[model samples]
Target: MVQKDMKLWPFKAIPTADGDNFKKIVIVVTYKGEEKQFALEEISSMLLIKMKQILETYLGSEVKNVVVTIPAYFNDAQRQATKDAGVIAGLNVMRIINEPTAAAIAYCLDRQCTSNGATKNILVFDLGGGTFDVSLVAIKKGVFEVSGDTHLGGRDFDNRLLSHFIAEFERKHNKDISANRRAVGRLRPALDFSCSITRARFEKMNKELFQDCMLPVQMCLRDAKMEKSEIHDVVLVGGSTRIPKIQQLLQEVRDPHVFSLHNIPPAPQGVPQIDVWFNIDIDGILTVSAELVGTNNKNQITITNHSGRLSK
Candidate 1:
């Protein structure tokens, strides 16, 4: 809810469990001239139902099964809650996999590295809109093992921007907009109040956050019992990874093999040979397959639930 523009919402103070066990997130909203309370999972079901409708329309068929990806740090209760959300959405939750793992699968497949008889250690950096995750994955003979996670992401960066601009607006106008939801929402887009933040200033404002991002990378490497040098490729995933400062920071960590499939420059060739496969079905079920490039040894995993989406 912190990530949402409260002004756009028709409700206020949506009650949530903070730092508590994975339980209920109850929200009240005005609907059809009536105020209604809903569990977070039910809200998720409503979104999923809408997504299912869109998917069915696009595919010209009914959709049921799905694979969801959650943050690697999600506890059992959180994972179960995600599956329950899927069930409530009328989807047969096929499997639950880590978000970083899914990104690794997508990366490996995009690079066609699963069929090659080469083993590589990959660092998957996934910084989405609301969460960040770093995974140290060993792609050995087609098997993937993941190792790190975090909760900070683009939303935190957003908060930094929000705080900065709110202070600026107050200084200029001599009025406090901090408590104004509509004011905050207006400030979010382009700072319509004639305020502009340069990239360097933005980076400076979130210097600590950029540094925090690296902590997970280091921890993942340590947890996986590997050195930074052992990582053959650093795969960047999610929208936040496109930020120039993020790219610069990651390049500082692993310059030569940093890769993103989003039209960023391709990694230099002759690095190594490997094979990987990733597929997403009509229902958004994800399947990852991989193998040593020249060997028959292969491994595969299917991911079905994505509860972390709700947390976002």
Candidate 2:
């Protein structure tokens, strides 16, 4: 993922362009003497020129057109940006597909979930180096609808650790390490190690960011009008989801005890005869309820595969 600082860099606009228009914010670099604005379209064209040359060299044939995919949650801006990238790369953009849609097709979701021709709710969890998002798809009668968070992703997690390391570096040296390229280059070696160390402290320090990972899951369930128990399974995609801290956040999302038990009303006992209680297990699958606690004749009900669904 491109860092936001680099993407929206030193110059916030193109000096030669129309006043206040931000075309150059996408790409501004020093060329020949003055800073020239090369739209991502132009830069992407440049990248394609080189890439096409390499492909022709290796394949001994001309490469003219290509197909591409983007994130499902990507809005119009991101989709347009990618098409621009393809156009500039010097190749005909054949077709653009959403990454999550590609994943569902690859996994044969319909064939897997369509049991007795009944619809099943599927959640696609996509976490990448730069972004994290979740998609809710309901497959029924060979059709589906999709909804999810497009902007969430892996980069936020990395940023948390990176920010931690930056603050630590600043605290130790009493110098801001983000001043300029030269300053950062001078200390890049030490900071690289800090990146590794940040992984160890990730879950410990980045609580809020981790909580974000669950919001999409909640949103998807709401939009789909399905309880968490209705989800047949979760599909984990992207490289960033493998991070231990990221993985742990998913576990917490599935945890039944993720919410406090304080609001739960104790089970009624025959119009106030005795106390009744309910408890959730850590796995969130089975729960045990005691008809009466601290009584020799206590009765309990063991429920297997409890829905574990949170009521709205």
Candidate 3:
């Protein structure tokens, strides 16, 4: 603080837990950059308390109408849990929008475009930290309508890549990490970092880590049902997607038509266009409160509510 010549730290830390994995993160968005950290604690309650202090200190007052964005595929329990966290912190959450929807809203504002006209279908393919979502929407007269959606996110890919690494590591080092709990825990960060960086540049760091972990990466992409040319553009989103190997994979799939396929589309002349935003770090989930929720993992298209009314 003294060295930086700053008065206050605008960011606060939050603890996140995924399965048995626990991390402490201090997140603060500023004019300079955003900070996401790894917390080194195990207890969930302790993390929550620390987060409350951080929020209070940063805001310098009670929070009002907090906007919590989450995944579209999240169950009711998960959604309620998030809201409960906010309540624990003494905040009234006005609404919880999906991350992608928030990004889209920001994108629209940044581009000076309005969703007020004839219905246009848009496909939001959001790949995030742990999950992925594919949303089809119909925008008309300032309202966004959902047509369809799906989820096959980064977590699945990570698991696939990790499995690949374990197999290769055992074959080469004769050391089975998948069976060793301690080593498996250690291996997670390495694999995530290595795969992430490989998408940007095959630096020495990634090479040293995943030199033998090839088959898994190949298989994961294959499981995605994506080939060199099949994916017109591998819209890079989520922190994992930043890996240089990923970019390479996407590049190899292209037909020397990077511009026509990979590049973001340009805006229309008079009808201003918003840049389709996708986060390459976190998952973007939009919330929809309905009477029904899905209980199965195979999230097939099934509508729960039917009023039996259709109008032209």
Candidate 4:
């Protein structure tokens, strides 16, 4: 038996353009599971340092090429920004893969799907901590090809959930949480985390996170037109997916067919409120920049995507 020592770690960062709020950073290590956290100010830098420290402590290997996953809907600037993040982490940029593509790659690696060369058109629905990406991929033998894809992701679900929380909390506490970013910021993770876990056992672990969060979740689940026991085999990709609420919810919503919970949460109609935000005319509801790492690359950065280049 040949001992395989190859390891690949994929990193992802999800930023909300609406409030310039960055939600989480995730790293999928080959055979080592995942490391994730919600990012704070200068988080990209702090995250890079943390990654280096983790690599030093855990792998005892020098950092080499890394695959950074960005949203498919992200423009050149957004992609560039993602690359810059990699550079900061002291990694030799291998390729800037879409979140869905990276996810499919992760799945392939995890499942050992690419031993030889085989081609198959696989549909990948990736709902991350902050964004959602739906992709159609052509895997030939071993070389994976990403065909069509869209960016309708998890953050949208969070926003929807956040809105629901605000409304519900206001009704209960008689105070608007939305207006208070601090409170919303603090409570958002707990509520968001619980909403993902639909498993019954999960309820026992994180009780407080779901105290006032249940009605909103139930309502959102209803609005999504799904019920418990309907979810199964949903690829729960991001940190948020680990939340028992999501797992539980998917169990209810995608019942019968097991939710993968392996890839990003697929854009089931009940999950992302796409129609409300996506304006076909504008190409996307909001624009993201893919930045290149260079000097003076502070806020006023330049990014290039498939569309073109933009100066920020």
- lDDT against the true structure, per candidate, is 0.69, 0.59, 0.43, 0.45
Candidate 4 lands at a TM-score of: 0.44
What candidate 2 gets wrong by more than 4 Å, as runs, is 1-24, 30-36, 43-63, 109-120, 140-151, 185-200, 252-312
Descending-lDDT candidate ranking: 1, 2, 4, 3
Best by TM-score: 1
Best by lDDT: 1
lDDT of 4: 0.45
Evaluate residue 113 in candidate 1 and report its C-alpha lDDT on the 0 to 100 scale. 71
Clashes of 2: 6
TM of each candidate vs. truth? 0.70, 0.63, 0.44, 0.44
- RMSD vs true structure, all candidates: 13.4, 8.6, 19.3, 22.4
Tally clashes: model 3. Answer: 26
Q: What lDDT score is found at residue 233 in candidate 1?
A: 72
The Cα error of candidate 4 at residue 239, in Å, is 4.9
lDDT of 2 by residue, 226-290 (tens): 67666665666787666555554454344444332232345655543445564535443333343
Q: Indicate the residue-level lDDT of 131 in model 3.
A: 53
lDDT of 4 by residue, 1-312 (tens): 001101100233334433566344433222345455433323455676687778778987777777666666678866766667767667777887666667667666776555766554333434455444434444443223222223223444455556655666777778765655446666666643233433344445444433322333344335435444432123335554444344433333333332111223356666532211111112211222222232222122222221111234
**Model 1 poorest 10 in a row by lDDT:** 303-312
lDDT of 3 at 188: 64
lDDT of 1 at 102: 84
Query: TM-score of model 1 relative to the true fold?
Result: 0.70
